[model samples]
Target: MNKLRLRVQILFTILTNGYVYGFLKGKIYQGPLKYTCVPGLNCYSCPGAAFSCPIGALQALLNREGFHVPFAVLGFFFLFGSLLGRFVCGWLCPFGLVQDLLHKIPLFRKLKRLPLHHILKFGKYAVLFFLVFIGSVFLFGGFAKIPAFCKYLCPSGTLFGALPLLTANPLLRSQTGGLFGWKLGILVLILFLSIIVYRPFCQYLCPLGAIYGLFNRFSLLQIHWDEDLCTSCAACENACPLSLTVQEISRSPECIRCGKCVKACPVSCLHFTAKSNGYSTKHQTCVPPGTNTV
Candidate 1:
């Protein structure tokens, strides 16, 4: 909801998917940048995408014949997670921007805490484990070379990849069948859910979020909590779309560092900290919940 964050999201989305020629021609870009992975979840199948999808790259590496290690993909995840954690999810992911905009539509009564929030938070991890890691490696081997997550569940691929490509390329449209319809249903369901629940896809399905969340505690960027300046007010919790308890927010892997809680802290007790700041955050100003802008 922050203007600066919104601007950054739009900027990154355009940078990652800036191929006008590819979009016009309805073809995937096969340039040198295609080999490099962007920090957030942009589908490599998108016509305008100039960068590789991180999840797609990981599947390509692991879906190899033997027990070859995906060192490059693993190292890429490590560097990204260690540096920024879910800041990428908060500020860069294209799909995240879609959900954010949908959440602001005011169509339905917004549910601050999504249904079964505590237990459903593990869904992303389950997807990362089963669909990505196991499904790619073992499930559809020999006969088919499909990346299970992208093929079956990635709404980003459906919304960005299938729609544009299918609309533009007749050859691609002729090939669509029950599988495409299934993916379309998934995309529609997720989009509908986003109207009521903020970031339902990020909360329940994105493997990338699961990976980055693991490093939230050890990432270079962090939200520091000042116990001394605390008034035990629950304003931060109420403001947080994910409903993270501010008392242990820094430790929660689910925290996207969206800064809503940071801005909602009435007493300036919560602020961003970098490792370069000697592990201590400054007493930055915070807007009260009533006065905070959307």
Candidate 2:
């Protein structure tokens, strides 16, 4: 499944940023496709980017002078989120691919889990509401729009957009200041931390992931856990990249639908459901960790 995911990631990365050769010539792709938003967080300013970021587009629309619903952006999320949910995060996001690769780097002392991890997971929601939504709307009454999270916190933007642009254009490098240093520091920290943590940004910072996560409960594609799996060894939970247990597997917002748990199941009872399918009740019953099923 991971290999399949890697392939998909590569394909999407290429498709979304297909103008790679242009970057070498110090030119960004300003084609008509730039108006369209990709479900993932690929930056619009990326020299090779063929699509705009949905989060960035939505925030920009929200920050406009006149009130107008961003139907295109909202509809894009609604369609994708309702169909696959954060599976987009698992399979499409270039930044997620970067983190996955970084985490694969062998480390003797890996930071598999951290203290207050569950609590900190809620930070993505805070970022969604506070930084992406409120900050964009409130911070700029005179300007066009302010992508607070992208400008301030998105390591993906720093790595893909800022660094590449600055490197390609020497003039921009000469104009660097304290803000550039701060963003560079953040990118370095995130890169360093990705070697140890699974996906620190997605779990704690990405507003787009948080929005997609809300749809996981009712997404058409879902992870089905068979109650007839026999032994409740908690193996699936251990295998889950996002740390979801079998009981929460059905409709977990945190689940990326990566199929790691499905692959890890000893009884071969876990599987993906194209539609909502009822599971066998006689084989077993497992409660999610840190919660009572009742």
Candidate 2: residue 228 lDDT (0-100): 58
lDDT of 2 by residue, 34-75 (tens): 888999999888888988989889878887786678788899
List the global CA lDDT of all models.
Answer: 0.87, 0.82
Best by lDDT: 1
TM-score of 1: 0.92
How far in Å is the alpha carbon of 85 misplaced in model 1? 0.9
Worst 10 residues of 2 by lDDT: 276-285
Candidate 2 segments exceeding 4 Å error: 140-145, 276-294
lDDT by residue for model 1 over 47-105, one digit each (tens)? Answer: 99999999999998878887578898888899999989898899989999999999999
Give the CA lDDT, 0 to 100, for residue 44 in model 1. 95
> How much is the lDDT of residue 172 in candidate 2?
79
